[model samples]
Target: MLLLNSGCGTKNKNSFESDIIIYGGTSAAITAAVQAKKMGKSVLVVSPDFHLGGLSSGGLGFTDTGDKSVIGGLAREFYHRIYLHYQKEDSWKWQKKEEYGNIGQGTPAIDGDERTMWIFEPHAAEQVFEDFIREYDIQVYRGEWLDRENGVSKSNGTIISIKTLSGKAFKGKMFIDATYEGDLMAAAGVSYHVGRESNDTYGEKWNGVQFGVFQHGHYFRDSISPFVIPGDPTSGLLPEISEEPIAPNGTADSKLQAYNFRMCLSKHPDNRLPFPKPENYDPSRYELLARVYASGWDETFDKFDPIPNLKTDTNNHGPFSTDYIGKNYAYPEASYEERKAIIKDHEDYQMGLMYFLANDPKVPEKVRQRISEYGLAKDEFIDNGHWPHQIYVRESRRMIGDYVMTEHDVLGDKTVPNPIGMGSYHLDSHNVQRLIGPNGYVQNEGDIGVKPKEPYSISYGTILPKKQECENLLVPVCVSSSHTAFGSIRMEPVFMILGQSSATAAVLAIDAKIAVQDLDYEKLKHRLKEDAQVMLLSERLK
Candidate 1:
């Protein structure tokens, strides 16, 4: 039913007809456009969002990069620019250089000799991406949502043109789906998997519904009654507690992991925005957290990771934290308005959580006082009411291409040919649903983490569609992978690396006058190496 890449030139000479049309204003989108420009290909980015750099420019400043060496090329260059930005004295306006000490995920935030910085502010990241655009003269159509219902017009398995909701049309020779949701790829009729598959699907150890498998302290520490009143099942289950039976362990299901906003909080009095009691904010929604406090699991401030200017990259930690479990299951396939509603629900819930912790009399005095000290960063994301503009979309629709990167590849058990990039992070998935444990207590499920022995190669095939499906399109952010491997490859830096690599391959494909799948790997690999992409492990890493 599908046709391979059609080797036809553009039907018309127009400004909308670019060499490459990349969708999504993600970090990958910017990098891909830059790479295409560097290769002398005219490119344009059609972003549904008004802002660029999805999570990188959002509030997820505490980067979750596993190995620094594996990240090179434009991805490394971006961070190097961040390092250069902070070198100036004026860069530290709110906090002194020595006042905010550099911290990271087991490494220094500022790497001087390497000329790369890992941790940064949300605005700083956006500035770097904006710089990439200005320097490259990259054309960007921001805030143009794709007309998913009928905008895409494909011919013989090749996308001819994409129309946006604004009645704008863009045609290109090659396409790249850089969005977190893989919206373009999905519209182009690419096969993508949504949620966790059974372990048997890819012979993976960490892929399915994991009920008792605990990684972080996200599970209920002590057995709390799932019922409304203390020990009476007749009183009925509490709100947000699922009454559905937990799926059998290692069984396949369509449920997805939780998503949350990586909040930017500040303790500075001048730079703190109080968490307003959001509209329709109900205090009873966070009664579980009150119970969590009563159980003596009070490590709420543990994940307030320090970035720059006395700000913290706050994340989900402990039981009943920022992750709104089971609320985002319909988001991947939801309509724009429906997705907006889901986002509002999550915002209300998280803001209500903050309010409950700070003002609720049911919370312990020590806990209340500690949480009350921090609020939304005043100078950050000012347009979006001081809250983060982007939610941490941990995992989304992953393409099932010619090759699917599985847990075996993630664990380095299988060899991956034609390496375009490398992913070294742990196989991390947040809690999918909050359900009543077998013991009739509230507990979260689907949070599983398995760290890799070392960084592994992400194959070029992972970004390529099946030859019969589409040959001109490349997916870098939501690449072809099983849920097991996507858990690691779904990281931001890897997305950047793959973005550059995918664009590079597209350039090579255009230059060679062939389909992307039929292009010479030897040539593609050489080009990537020339661009300073780390392709192999060093002797020390081995």
Candidate 2:
């Protein structure tokens, strides 16, 4: 049954209508809904997951905020509410407030004067999102999966209504696809790209297959063999290593960056749950990682980033870590059942890896002892067996709209027109594939991290579809951008910024009786500024 709130009671049971319909349960969806209601417009959030705040509350507590100055609008307000929650004495259940230091991404987590906290626990972030929904009286339908095949009803180039898998239909004047997978936008027959574009296609240097260019430390520094038996090709390639032909440098490919759960782990004795071994645990599957360990590459605990309450936002760091590479190639366009299988495969792989590391005798004693001290936080994700509900979908189907944001736009080499928001994070793409290198060694490819010279503006046209494709839709999470450009814009704070900006545009377009593509940029800019959206760092810093 659909979990419809009081806002839907005024409408028919099977069909509900609103001024704006946001299809997702992400952090962006929450922000977009709040912004729409703030403008006195009716909004509905059709969420696929039971929980809100996608990755923001799904174990990604240690945020990837490059320049905190560029974060504003409802994004900053969300952090401010997180700060307020931690101020209460009862909020510190596992650790004292003073014991949890104020260190964030090279800055203070608790900024007293600014009244914001960048780092937080998963439940804390979810609580803030729930508060936003309750305070704004936003109507939400949880566990409503979008019927991608025959769900969207369109007239000419505009979406009329959308149906869910449960036979419930929703009608709205404007729609926002705030999903991480862009399911609503894809179902509406919008033009989108599935994989990395070549440098020749975008006329940018960092937009394609980065084979030999290892920018981050997530590559094979030492020679690690990729065979079942070292130096024996006849023994066949290892289990997880891909046998596909490697593409040339700067060329296009369909492979996507790896996906993993940003695990929230705890060292607290009373609240720690041991790493559960999967039903199909295979110790031999992590042979490549064991060999990497044999080659003396031991940086496994480098990315155990700390959040509040003695919990760590554990992320993929070294060569063979949490990221399950080369296993999600068909995920962006896969069916719901297929995607569930993929997610299950990832969970099994990660859990098997953890079990192998902590219990397997082949692992070094020192490494096993170090990892044995930590376990999944039993108090978090109480409903989902202490596992995160959302996977870190680094990149997926990006809409190719009227204006495609390339690496040049991200690097500030090309100017962006009609700015909606700003992003300062580095172009960070995780490893896409672990294949046999040219020199016959196991090597990872497609890990690139390049910082921008300054903060870059995200264009307003990014969220809009092509004029002929869809006129009333806005895509914030999977905006129009090249594979490399999406890396910088895919952060949680930036998603919230674009979500609020998208809603403001949706409401203005509705009031002015125009398409989202035809909305006046000046009017949108005025409202965004009035709502405290930071369009330019120079303007905000001044």
Candidate 3:
């Protein structure tokens, strides 16, 4: 919960009030809070999470950093801290420092020249985020959920105060919605988008339904039937297969990309726990996966990206992998209870899939023998049954702000307005729906991968709401962007970059006593450069 306008006095002087109020406990939220505090503005982080870092400290430690040079500001500082942590001789417990070779997406994981580590354990990332909070002396209230139905209290197109589900109110001069879901922004009566828009809407080549485009190996290559009985449609469709007909290419729909857990697994015998059999584990739910395996798809461990100390950040790879496709479309607008149920369902599905692959008699003996050597890292996520506390929410509600970032912005075909940060990641989107294709074989759709022209600037307008809607709100995580455009900007490093930029704007807006949209771009740019944020690629080269 958050409050935008703060001219009036609160009912109680002891109530929590700050210059900037940030919602969410994501990596972006932490960075935003730190930036605000560093700028000499009191900031409060109202987090709905029990942990500090969201996915960065949760389990997705193998970073998705696209262009390391463009990653600056506190985002790079975080990786530097990780490097410093690993420099100590006592940090390695399961494997020696030298044993973890210097391997990254392209560059070395441990860059001595840059003094940064791109890959690390989940606990190490959490400690770095916690250290930032402690060093800055930022006030944080965990487990405070926004009362979405009636939490926001706005006066003259400005938020006055926000109350959480527990009836705690917070007041602030400026607010930053640094959440992955954009809950605070949505609750403030701001307009947002939930699903992919039509290609014609944004003039994007890959904005809508992608039916035949299979950039990754996550599509069916064999003629696998979707029925419970092979080739018998009357026997009913198999579990996890969509019965709806495939939509036209480039058409708009309410479908969402898949969600999954980035599991941190360890092969070390001393720090490994075998995959647990989840409650109500059903083997039939994975019948489509069995067919995929029978089709000679043996690339199960392709995405087991390694980090320090002999741990792997396991992600979705082949068809019917960890991604629970077509199951998260309702998550963006669902109630908190409904969202929890969806998360639990994903946990059970992934857990059952692991158990099936590791022990089921139907599984290939060679695959089972290999996967059985790895288990959950015993020291990570110890409080949550050794499982990740956060789910990889690849995409969610995107605010339609002052300007919507389109695919043209990502490709450098159109000039971005008010540069705040830059991202160079290839436009990557996971599979959205699994259904029967025209050839009567089950197939996956909406997996797209296209490299951008180059690193492009992200606009400050993308985070600023329309001046008429709200005057003092800034959104960093669920920013204003089209579907294909957000595919590039939705990385953790970019989130942190936007987080710092948003906080800087918030504090500057407070000092100027103006709306967030009315802040001078020149002033904002000067502060970002002063704070070491790389808004241009040429600056990094210098």
TM-score for each candidate, following the candidate numbering: 0.96, 0.98, 0.98
The alpha-carbon deviation from the true structure for residue 403 of candidate 3, after best TM-score superposition, in angstroms, is: 0.9
Note the residue pairs that clash in candidate 1: none
Preferred candidate (lDDT higher): 1 or 2: 2
By lDDT, the best candidate is 2
What value does the lDDT take at residue 257 in candidate 3? 89
Cα lDDT listed for each candidate: 0.87, 0.91, 0.90
Which 10-residue window in model 2 sums to the lowest lDDT?
1-10
Model 3 lDDT on a 0 to 1 scale? 0.90
Off by over 4 Å in 1: 1-15, 539-542
RMSD (CA, angstroms), candidate 1: 2.6
**Worst window of 10 by summed lDDT in candidate 1:** 1-10
Model 2, span 1-542: residue lDDT tens: 11112233335678988889999999999999999999998999999989999999999998898888888899999999999999999999999999997889857899898989999999999999999999999989999999999999998788888999999999888899999899999999999998889999988898778898889889989988899989999999988899887888888888899999999999899989999999999988999888988888889899989898999999998888999999999999999999999999999999899999999887888999999989999999999999999999989999999789988998989889999999999998999989888999989999999999989999999999998999999999999999999999999999999999999999898888788998889999999999989887665632
Better of 1 and 2 by TM-score: 2
Best of the two (1, 3) by lDDT: 3
In candidate 1, what are the lDDT values of residues 191-232, reduced to their tens digit? 998888998988877888899999978889899888889789
